[model samples]
Target: DAGVTQSPTHLIKTRGQQVTLRCSPKSGHDTVSWYQQALGQGPQFIFQYYEEEERQRGNFPDRFSGHQFPNYSSELNVNALLLGDSALYLCASSLEQGGGYTFGSGTRLTVV
Candidate 1:
């Protein structure tokens, strides 16, 4: 199944370059939300996907995008990468009740 099979991990991408990060949920979760967290700062919501379609989005630009597969696996694609984008990219899977967000242990992405 496309469900999660293990704990989520971090991904690092270079500055000014595009990168694709992958995450699979074993909890039978269909919703995937992405966030960018800078050092000493709270996580900033990027966007969320459900049922293989874009559902909700944060203030991030179009450069931040994502996709959810029919199998429940998800991908977060960052385009036109910039130095300011340096931070932790976290993927959370939940029912979108607006609470109880399950996320990976801070994935640090440093640019430069």
Candidate 2:
């Protein structure tokens, strides 16, 4: 079965623009998590979704939002983008009962 899948492997956006990144979870996984990874830095947790509700969020500002669908697919939306937002956005999926996570290749977003 396919692991998590993310869309638009690379993107370029201008400041103040908005971007939506997508993720489809692996088979049988019911939870999805998003992360942002700057160059030379480890991934920082953004938020997590389960049962179509945001279960937890990290230290990111309100510009970041997410949604999880019935099928366990998810979307990460960023509004009023800033150059500092440029980074590799990662998607991970795991069972709600706790298990190892499967991550996607990640979407590379660059804000100018």
Candidate 3:
């Protein structure tokens, strides 16, 4: 019954550096999705994983990649980060049929 959880609630990264963020899906869920939300903007989907493989992806640069493990936890990695990467990274989880998604508070990444 545990909800999704993300680490380091806040992150600070420099331009051109790479960063990796982690997420743990809700109990009994097998799918995980990542989204990026800029200030005042709705979340933009990055990718979704099911069965430990990526099932759907959005229009984002190759720099954005992710992985889902057997435990249903996930990790998002962004390489050559840009100032534009500064945003909130949210992780959501749902069942196979993909009902309403449950999102974490998100890790606020600030690129300076």
**Across residues 6-98, which tens digit of lDDT does each residue of candidate 1 receive?**
223545567778877776764756678788888889999988888899998999888888888997768877898888888877777777555
Best by TM-score: 2
Task: Return the clash pairs for model 2, or none.
Answer: none
lDDT of 1 at 44: 90
Stretches of candidate 3 above 4 Å error?
none
Q: Per-residue alpha-carbon lDDT of model 2 for 1-112, expressed as tens digits?
A: 7888999899999999999999999999999999999999999999999999999999999999999999999999999999999999999999999989999999999999
In terms of lDDT, the best-performing candidate is 2
lDDT scores of the candidates, listed in order: 0.74, 0.98, 0.94
Backbone clash tally for model 2?
A: 0
C-alpha-based local distance difference test score of model 3: 0.94
Give lDDT: candidate 1, residue 36. Answer: 84
lDDT of model 2, residue 9: 99
Each candidate's TM vs. the true structure? 0.82, 0.99, 0.96
Question: Which clashing pairs does model 3 show?
Answer: none
1 or 2: which has the higher lDDT? 2
